[model samples]
Target: MSHQRRRGQAAIVYPTKVYTDSRGSRVETADMDNPIPVTAVFVPQRSSRAEVAGQQDIDVTRMIVSADVQGIDSWSRVFWNGSMWDVVVPPAYHHGTRHTRHYTMDIRRRPS
Candidate 1:
């Protein structure tokens, strides 16, 4: 399966806490206790797709994976190449089988 050939390991982040600080402020943080190891290919968004998006300021990168990766949603974040990519939309799942499931993610690069 393509998942077996995955070379990059991605960290999946989820919110785990929200608390008030001593100075009467609220702080929200994410939890990164585990990483989802999957093979992924990163590619530049095609002009056709970009034009359809109709947003010129932000850049989009498409990530492809073949595995039944769990615990990810639009609210989740993916860490790769020393940068974080926000899940542009909910992950699209396809090609279901007894042991493998394919996932496609369209992620937007976050400002550094």
Candidate 2:
């Protein structure tokens, strides 16, 4: 995370319902409300790579935001720079400092 501030937005997505599809497969529906304005720093962790088994590339990107940001978890979806990211790891305070400065989250961008 960098000390310089960067502007961004985050949206908290909630699972609205779960039902069966036509093929008897389970499906999930999520609802996203208005975006919440945020200021933070975007950090890219290790290099992005593809997973052969799942056939999905797991690109891990970290979002470092103020401790005040709330309702962000693995279920939440983040929108940044015209792209959406899945919150793979929930927000947490690094070094056990109780998020004195900022909290971080690990996000993954799946193939469209």
Candidate 3:
């Protein structure tokens, strides 16, 4: 269901798509008129043991603060046990968007 089209020396790329019928029994194919270019950048990390240790330290601090604020008195260093994160909320009520921060740090930092 994908093709490259050319007419009179003009080249065009289309993303052919598949569709399902209302009954969800029959499948149909349609040609796309325009092809969109999607671009993304990914950076690979090459870290030293020191950097890893620093990151782990920061993570530990953050988790401690998170547990303290959420009244997560009972926890396990290892997950999968019920008592681990139950200090914050009852095991049954664990749902919805809980308090968490989407944070980032710059790899380039001034030496302290």
TM-score of each: 0.60, 0.62, 0.19
What are the lDDT figures for the candidates, one per model? Answer: 0.64, 0.65, 0.23
Q: Name the best candidate (by lDDT).
A: 2
lDDT of 3 by residue, 7-82 (tens): 1112121223456778887553323343322111112233333455354311111111111122112221212112
Give candidate 1's error at residue 11 in angstroms.
Answer: 6.5
**Candidate rank order under TM-score:** 2, 1, 3
Candidate 2 deviant stretches above 4 angstroms: 6-31, 49-54, 94-100
* Residue pairs whose backbone atoms clash in candidate 2: none
Off by over 4 Å in 1: 3-30, 46-57, 96-100
Better of 1 and 2 by lDDT: 2
Worst ten-residue run, lDDT, model 3? 1-10
lDDT for 57 in candidate 3 is 17
lDDT of 2 by residue, 3-96 (tens): 4544444433332345698999986543475356677677888554665766556678887877766666666677675677787886887553
The CA lDDT at 84 in model 1 is: 77
On a 0 to 1 TM-score scale, where does candidate 2 land against the true structure?
0.62
Q: What CA RMSD would candidate 2 show?
A: 5.8
lDDT of 1 by residue, 72-103 (tens): 66766778777877777777887766445667
